[model samples]
Target: MAQPDVPWPLLRSVEALADAPLAQIADRLRQATLPYMGSSALVIFTEDCTGRPQKKAGEEEIISRVSITELDSLRATIPDEAPWFGHAEIAGRSRAVLALKYAPSHALLVLTDPQPLESTPTPGLEMVRYLWRIAARRIQEKVADAPPSYLLESRAASAERLRVTAELTDLHSTTLETLLAALRSPSLDDAAARSTVTDLAAKALVALRTLSDRTTDLVEEPVATAFERLREDLKPLTRFGGVEVEFIEPPLNGRALPGEVAHAARAIVRGLVLTMMEEPEVSRIRTQWDCDGENLLINIRDNGSGTLSADAPSIVRLDRRVQALTGHLQLEVMPGWGADVFVTLPLDPPTRPAGDVAEWNLAARELEVLQHLVAGRRNRTIAMTLGISENTVKFHVRNLFKKLDVNSRTEVVALAHSHGIR
Candidate 1:
């Protein structure tokens, strides 16, 4: 007699079973197989670390009574010549036992109705073997096709992305360093510094666009167009400070940048101008800019008293901001003559776009908390680092959660990391 055919839909169901936890998959297998066998109980077993066949699924009572040691003993009794189908009386009831090796390393045993075994036995045995093979193959296939766990995979990907981001950040820092070096040089005149600033601004804008395009997908529209605006904005500082600004390559229209970075850049420039204004009798200031593949170089110089000390509080604060974003800031103050401030910022903003107010509208202090949160610091640690009380930290955290629409620390960290906050 020919064996019954297997259901194609049942095989297709295996595809959806992939990526399920092992326990769920085993339970699914038991449910699928039990109906065909007319069995009240089903048990699936796999080898454990100790070389014992461990029961993976079935009724607890049935599993407890079925011993792996006894099964091994029974297998030993079956000779190589013994037919795969046999009668087995266990716990007083006589049942049909069918055995088949599905994979090279795995075996299956089915215990089923006794009535069919006594009549038309061959087809029943063949069908049982076929079903076992299908089940085993499906299980292995599902296991092999499992998707990666999001928690692990996402974190690893984020880490790799951050490393690449840091490298790009270094390019901006190098640009600042070159600019600062030129500003500090006694020999560079107003004309030379102005030329350097213009060139540096143009090149920095290109680098910014390149970095922005490469690292983030959610960049602001205005970022691509703000390069010229930046140069124009900086022009007044040189002019008013008695510094001549030259554009070797005029600033180009680049993509809109994150509002925060652009705002911060403006703030830094404003701060530099304010610092310069504190001194009188400074006659000439020259600012220049250029790009050399790896970095954007900006040079600003003045013939005034270079009396700015690197250790000043304002300088230290600027340094902290630069260092936090993996950039660099240098200051040179030569007494009675001139003061030069050089700042480098990454082409990519240190923070990702927090999106419109609807998505992640953060207040100033909340943004500060987010920055620390991304560093993987604990609440108490963040409180200490920020010089706030633990209670204040909790308050900020609660507020941050509400603003960012995140519920947990982990989610906040993921969000922060994605946006380049840390």
Candidate 2:
């Protein structure tokens, strides 16, 4: 039988979750179906060996309130391949729970305060089942062989530091260049030049002083720093494990990568290491990174007997992460020899022009607020600078969050930064 076409939104949701952390999977599913299904809270969880529902790091609060006994009852009521949708009382609140068995584990997607569906197609529920299946597989992999506890935490911290430092460097560099240009302006009076320099100098001094007590590097080249950090991250892995990872430095003259690219590349390499480590006999690996002005090329080769394929479960996860950035992953395996993986990530900014808040139908004032929000300005500071009241700033921020489909300031900043909205 011919299969029906999948919905575009559902497909995009699957792709987004491909590289997303397990904790964020439920929310991603919720957001993807929100347009058709209406606003509702969602949660995903799996059962442990003892039949107790275990929570992933990013599980929502509402899901936490549902008792394990309720989940067990739902599982018993629904067939493994089918979904059950019904109202249930959880934690003194009535919610609609969609229960399904997604392979090795059972997942419950609870919709709290769910609005009644007005003749939505059955295919919508099927799509939800498919999405949950994908998430379930990822959760199982984590259960089988998760990364060391500190790897993700350390990588996240490092990435944030790099992002903030990179942004600050760009800001100060532009400010200094503009200050120089202002000084060289032919129409500028000596008094105006001095005043301009004094004001800029004071701001720069404050910035420098604030960053001095921190270990953040403001002027370092990004690509080199990425490789250096990769080495540090792999140090513990190499030291304890029998593997020896040979690091080949990229050309020093190559163009630097954006902060996000550098961070993602480091993460990609780290993931590759973890994947290859699954082979018990894998003792030696060689990794290289290069930037060809347009794309970041990464090559990794291992000396163990080739057992991992391009489509291996772990590699599939890695591929999703690369694809999230519009990048590509290639794997070469020699059955008796070894495996080689290559990744290509673009260096260009996203095609969408930054500050084009029109896509989100953001008002002019809201766009102004978004820019300041991306710059890490506080609500009070934004209000003062825009000459608006504090309450007005809050109103605009709320609108920004709603328009951007994000919940927190960090997500808004990250999304805007990815779109080249500096």
Candidate 3:
């Protein structure tokens, strides 16, 4: 007799996610949930991977244009509760949404234009929620086990995004402030109507600034807290991997690490420990971190056959991560003894050498202003671009003129262009 037809689709989805790469998780998750719930879009906002917080799949227009302000606003509505269903602003327009927050990681899952696909709403909702929980947990799990290349890429992207967000907040804040001033003017007619609009604008401005601050917060973590979290990340392995592991903590007063650095550091050490554990002779591993105000020093040693090869792919990847941050890694192996690994990660990013335009000895900010001027941006425009005041832009421009030995803005631009400052 033929048994019941297995739920091949569901099983396949689960199997797919089990080994899905990080870049494809959102798409895979969306496909998995589609059978249970119909939606135009699926978005996962998780701070676990600081580099790329939003993993999205759906209408390209919506996912591409969705703002942190919208997500933060939705997240705010469900402080102690989740599974919120309503119409909310998404991608600059209002869309029906199903929002869920994973309490474990505060990760948010938003399904836009959602509807039941299983004939009844309750059953579909329950299934979607369960799938979300699994996905949310998987998000952090993937981050913990992320490869060196992904970690490095995440750091670069996170840093650039953070810089852009801060600038955007400053630029828009100024615009909104001007709008508020105009709205509050006694010369404007319809005072009451104007006042209501002004209040809403003020709130939006506040939310915008709050979103920028949150982005900055995600870019760095206190060294002590980062290390503590690392311990937590490795706790499972220590408990179940059947190996003796010890952690020597760094000082509480150590400098805060850039989010990427903290993550890379943890991943580097974890990889080392795992590689060492692969050796049958290995029984114990010890890891330690210390900060000397300028660098994060890491040491991991293992009692093994000392067969860990420096040229191994895993070791190479780990070393590449260290070098990406302008850090150094050294390996010491003794055949009869064990393996000792040393890593030094700089607390501060490497100072970038000045470009061809540096011959005039222009400071970084001056060169930035010069670049904008070459592009024919006025003081106000440059100020907006750099998130500085117009007066500060003028100051930088004046300094640029003197440094480049140019009299007028035109001459300054010409000189910059001639020197390939662009």
Candidate 4:
């Protein structure tokens, strides 16, 4: 009875059935009966491997839909026919049975018209069998092509749980740092310490809440989102220090750098704050960050004693950290005024030639000298251009060669040329 006039649209339009997963396909066939029978109630069954047919879907009407147990009992009463379509007496009423072999693995059975049959030929039975074949093929295709829908859903849920765990780890780290700072306070009283602990707890809660908001249902969050959440969590610290910190541009929405870089940056900024300001005098601190094509620029300025000692250990450590990243740090300290700290980090470091130019951890000044050296300039010419002594130029060149692991000026020149350093 399978024909081209079958109701394909009805079968395809069932929201979750078009790509029917194997486990749910039987239910889909059962649900099909409501539309196929053009009645409020219908029952459907599909035979399992053991010749026992299981009831799949139906309405709750007592007289119309039969349960799987009832269908199983009635299975022995069904006749084997070429295109099984017939009527039978069940519970003292004549009900129509339409059975069709959907695939080698399964067969569909629709039980309807329990009261009496209208004498006319009902194409509905034929249509039901046709739709079953289409649905069976679709279920087979989905099984062959991909994992079941439930399996994918489970995987996605697992990934989300892992992400939340990582976020919790980050929150714990921040909390530990704050607690360590609080414990170092000089005015250690029982009450004051308790208050400090409370404050830390509140801050941790705020951080966790912010992180949860940003990361809900996110399998992989962008670095920018994480940074923005951190900024929000640290807002309370700004009020404590009388500093009005702001992020000039949006948080960076890109891949995350290694955690070491983020940790080092945080340390440097913290040291700058502690070194330049007393507990009560500093009014405001503004941090601005931006990207300029090839480099990332972070500027931290504070309204504090701008005077910085040349031998300040904190600043020295910060400078070393920045330099190690192949970046430059500028400290503009104006005594009796505010200070501005500027950092520039290249997107990628230039490649050094083999053996030569390998050991050279080029200082900013030496980098300038090497640039000139790569331009084919002699030490005297470089000194004249940089407004430095020829002896100073030689000193820088010597350091450059040592850092670059180069033996001679010719090797340096060749390495620079090969790397397009000029």
Off by over 4 Å in 1: 1-227, 234-260, 291-297, 333-337, 348-400, 403-422
Give the per-residue lDDT of model 4 (tens digit) for 105-156.
3444555452222432455555555556666566434422332222222223
Off by over 4 Å in 3: 12-24, 73-89, 92-95, 102-106, 120-122, 129-153, 173-206, 240-244, 276-284, 292-295, 302-317, 320-326, 334-338, 346-422
Supply candidate 1's per-residue lDDT for 134.
57
Which run of 10 residues does model 2 get worst, by summed lDDT?
48-57
Clashes of each: 39, 0, 0, 7
The C-alpha lDDT values of all candidates are 0.51, 0.65, 0.80, 0.54
Candidate 2 lDDT over residue span 1-422, tens digit each: 99988767656877887766644666676776665555345655453211113332223565435554455455567665665667776545666655556644445555455454557665566556666667677655543333432222223323444466567767876777677666667776787667778677767756654553232332123577668878987899889977888999988788866544565677789899989888757889999999888889999998878988776788887787777567899998887778899999886533545444558888989989988987889999999999999999999888986786554565567566646677
Alpha-carbon deviation at 203 in model 4, angstroms: 42
Question: Rank order by TM-score, top first?
Answer: 3, 2, 1, 4
> Model 4, residue 160: what's the lDDT?
32
Order of the predicted models by lDDT, top scorer first: 3, 2, 4, 1
Model 4: residues with Cα > 4 Å off, grouped in runs: 1-223, 229-236, 251-260, 355-422
